[model samples]
Target chain A: MTLRAASTAAADRARIRAGEHTGPTSGLAPGLAQANLVILPADESLDFPRFCVRNPKPCPLLEVTDTGSAHPDCVAADADLRTDLPRYRVFRDGRLVDEPTDIAQFWRSDLVAFLLGCSFTFEWALAAAGLPIAHQAQGVNVPMYVTNRRCISAGRFDGPLVVSMRPFAPDVISHVVDISARFPAMHGAPVHIGDPEEIGIDDLAAPDFGDAVVVGADEVPVFWACGVTPQAVAIQARPSLAIFHAPGHMFITDRHHDDFDTGESHDHP
Target chain B: MTLRAASTAAADRARIRAGEHTGPTSGLAPGLAQANLVILPADESLDFPRFCVRNPKPCPLLEVTDTGSAHPDCVAADADLRTDLPRYRVFRDGRLVDEPTDIAQFWRSDLVAFLLGCSFTFEWALAAAGLPIAHQAQGVNVPMYVTNRRCISAGRFDGPLVVSMRPFAPDVISHVVDISARFPAMHGAPVHIGDPEEIGIDDLAAPDFGDAVVVGADEVPVFWACGVTPQAVAIQARPSLAIFHAPGHMFITDRHHDDFDTGESHDHP
Candidate 1:
């Protein structure tokens, strides 16, 4: 199978819905905003949104669908939440049940879906600004680790923060920060810049999740709050039922990544 | 009778608690952040926070208290929410019931309090940058209007967007914008720049709320999403019981105004 950038978000999602695109959505629909999807029962809906609000860096909420509704009206027009994503992970009582291409069979009227902003939007910005993405260059997944920092607990959601890492030359870190900071809807800027041990990462080559990449002698490991934090928290909380997009496979929204640029509008975030 | 700047936030709040201070909290504790307060029952708790998240420009939430608690631990350390402000307005089923200095008698275990960032933080930034405040200079309230723009509805809280007007010299508008844009927690930047008619303001002399300030011939009227928006929406929604700080009698937080400068820490917002 050949990997190519789809020209339109609608077309890309159509392919995913039709089962023609089942691989990771990392580079598909290049300029479109990709989101992490989390579906929970209505019983847990109130606390979950509050959790996202309390820990915004790791869980920047884009749009939360009304209970039992599959449409995320804020980010996309007439998009179905249950079938838009490439793949999904279903958890029963906090344990991974299965990874499936479509969740329409498991859809329940009591479920609420939350669309969270992903770092891919800012990665597009960083790459456009000439910053190299280590994982993409190495043809592997971005390194992720469980940080020592704990997210503020909301109801049943509580866990350590998770971060994704990218190595950048020391001289260009400031430029990298500026470009990424403009999109707070996406994980805004690097949470930790220089040292890995300070954030409780024992080694860069051994990421808790994703593939490891080489860190140059003069490069610093930059970490951004990952959308995985919320998923991890949801798992640890042991809710009776929960659903999330499989890692690296995201829901593509109609909004372009640059549409989230700060100061463009008052309500972007 | 002299409205001198209190030496510190703690001192200012103490004076307000003791009834020694009854004037508007503007400039009372220079450099400190002032907040707009809203207290609602737990039954309406879930939707109110969602409303703030949806319309961040008009209702940039600073801190939301634990259910039934009167303390805002994030913004001010050990500050009592019930009696710390100079005045409060009580509403019963959306109608004004009473104006009280302390809401101790009305406090209930099922109530939740939200502290929203106020324009005073950015107004301080504007003054520090040497931009004149028209209302303060003229000894009147800042002009505010209910625009035709409707805030995205969250649960039952739905209403038109309310904006505060500040006239700035055409040449200095950019400087004003640059400074205010840095404080996203405090209604960052102007929503509209010049023509009020564009956002549906008919008469400049008459505003839906607040006193009208003069719009100099060479000055452009800059409008920012007002903090009063949530209060207006709450009133319109008509929750069973609601409490809010009286107009201009804001709650002062220990954090300095500039402490909310963007990109400082992930948890600030």
Candidate 2:
């Protein structure tokens, strides 16, 4: 495989593929997109992509690799899925089995890889738009909660929708909505704003996953569809074999953030 | 299944479902969205949805019905796909076999339906925005041509891209671009703006499908991906049984034009 576009993303993927970098990909490839990876057997994974389409907010699809092909030609020209991500999590019948730096040994001819839009794209857009992210400012992982809204199921992949919270003062919430709405592939706008109980969230300090943050005076908590959905669904559906990127360790692609604007020409996954 | 929302679109669907309306659905539901319909069996049509996701420009998906279900609960809650469309064209082994008003006779136990975003949404937006459409003013079908662009192939569906032309004067082309870009699900933005032959179109007056209108002096031709792509591919791929909405006779849904704006909440299918 060869990369037609040169960017820091290609360099990062090369390092991860070589087993030289085995850490989180959060800080790498500053302007490019980092995808949430889910690789499943071709024979059993038909409904997963369908699930993504039905629930686009929580599971925005970026690129789906051809069956048995490790290369996702549309998103990254030279990238290889088998060893591209910094870290990997192997799920066997919905149980976590191993965390490997590379999955060349686990690669199968019947595997199909799915790359989903990550919040990092929206966070990048927010930061660029001068919107302050609460979790980032507090130096804590964004808080995630499992909401009561059940996803419209497709086959066996079904679960409660998970959301990541970011608090913004009431003054700037409108701008946040407008800016985030500009990137639908990146979870788009908040699924719920204001009351947590409206969507079945009971606590602000205690979250289902990640760290809690301080909600300042008169600040409204905003929740967006989280990229952790596929992982949650995999644990429930219990697929025979599923491979995913470990938390915060993503597949950096040659595609830039702007390419996911929902304009037909750009988001071609 | 019941409709949660009611509009003129629902009334129009009721008329068509009763077999009282056997004409094109263009002017039926003025403000609501109309969809291009394609139905295939569940067992053999796995790759068709994948093809739509990959080639979203021409095939932006609105709602994909559950396996063996004719009710598109998302787009039209109570409408039945087997009878709601004004007309249906049945293709057998890649050749047009019948054009029936209703496909209840052809419906099978494992059939799956796909509803795609049509140019009607964008045209509705354009008209609402007060932009003049060339073909509509001339009272002709929008001219369409087979382009050299090859859509990303999936399983048994593969074919060349088809685009519909809309001529706009130089001064208003930018506004037209901005307006159409808002509705990505509706074949968003012109795939080719300036030259016809540049994208493989030879003559402006001669189109592969649909009627051509006269292009005024100084008005440049803009071409957007047409919804006929899936039909063309079905013809080439030759699925054992494929059904589509007869040209100009679409499935009017309860979804409004603004609902398709890339805003996460509005367009949920």
The model with the greatest DockQ is: 2
TM-score of chain A of 1: 0.94
lDDT of 2 by residue, B1-269 (tens): 12433557778888888878999888887777889999988887877877887888898887888788898877776889999998999998889999999999999988889989999888887888788998999988999999999999987899999999998888777778867887777888778788888889989899999998899888889889999998898778888899999999999888777677764333211
For candidate 2, give the lDDT of residue B91: 93
Local distance difference test, each candidate: 0.84, 0.84
Q: Which stretches of candidate 1 lie over 4 Å from their true place?
A: A1-7, A263-269, B1-7, B263-269
Could you tell me the lDDT of residue A263 within candidate 1? Answer: 37
Task: Kindly list the interface RMSD, in angstroms, of each predicted candidate in the order they appear.
Answer: 6.3, 6.6
Docking class of 1: acceptable
* lDDT tens readout by residue for model 1, A1-269: 01133247778888999999988998888788899999999886667876776677898877777678898877777678788888999999999998999999999998888889999988898888788998889999999999999998877888999999999988788877767776777888778887889989988899999999999898888899999999999999888889999999999988887566653333311
The best candidate by TM-score is: 2
- Assess the local accuracy of residue A41 in candidate 1 as a C-alpha lDDT between 0 and 100: 91
Residue B106 alpha-carbon offset, candidate 2, angstroms: 1.1
Candidate 2 CAPRI level:
acceptable
Q: Quote the RMSD, in angstroms, for model 1.
A: 4.6
